[model samples]
Target: MSTGGKVQWINPHMMRAQNFTIRFVKPSRHMPGIVALREIRKYQKSTVTLIQKFPFQRLVKEIAQNLKEEFRFQSSAVDAL
Candidate 1:
């Protein structure tokens, strides 16, 4: 899926001007990390809009436990995200 716009540079050094797209790879049962990464990337893209309309603390409380158990994410890591 594409974000469908020019990349906004939060920091000049963080990204290039080249076009970017996210493509799905074939799923593998054994790679939970890859699955988590994909899900996080999807969330990262929408985070700005999501946070504006939703209560972030509520959302985090709802999903934090699941993220920790399913992906083996530490509390600090989930908080950082």
Candidate 2:
């Protein structure tokens, strides 16, 4: 079920279940250029980057405002109940 453009609850009994599987591959350091590619991937993952097009502070403020409105609505709903 959904509320306020978000999923509030899910009925597991009514949903289809599937088996989860995971595969692991062993890395071979003896492979040519594999080590360098792995190092580049590691560096890319470790580095933190921010978008320059939008103001981060404004985004945070908007999120805070949305949360505040949601909280107020929930509080009023509980009071009614």
Question: Tell me, what's the RMSD of every candidate?
Answer: 18.8, 22.3
lDDT of 1 by residue, 26-67 (tens): 432445588789989998888465453236555666686666
Tell me how far the alpha carbon of residue 75 in candidate 2 is from the true structure, in angstroms, after superposition.
Answer: 29
Task: Give stretches of model 2 more than 4 Å off.
Answer: 1-48, 69-81
Off by over 4 Å in 1: 1-30, 51-81
Compute the lDDT for candidate 1: 0.55
**TM-scores, all models, native as reference:** 0.25, 0.24
**Candidate 2 vs. truth: CA RMSD?**
22.3
**What is each predicted model's overall lDDT from 0 to 1?**
0.55, 0.50
lDDT of 1 at 67: 62
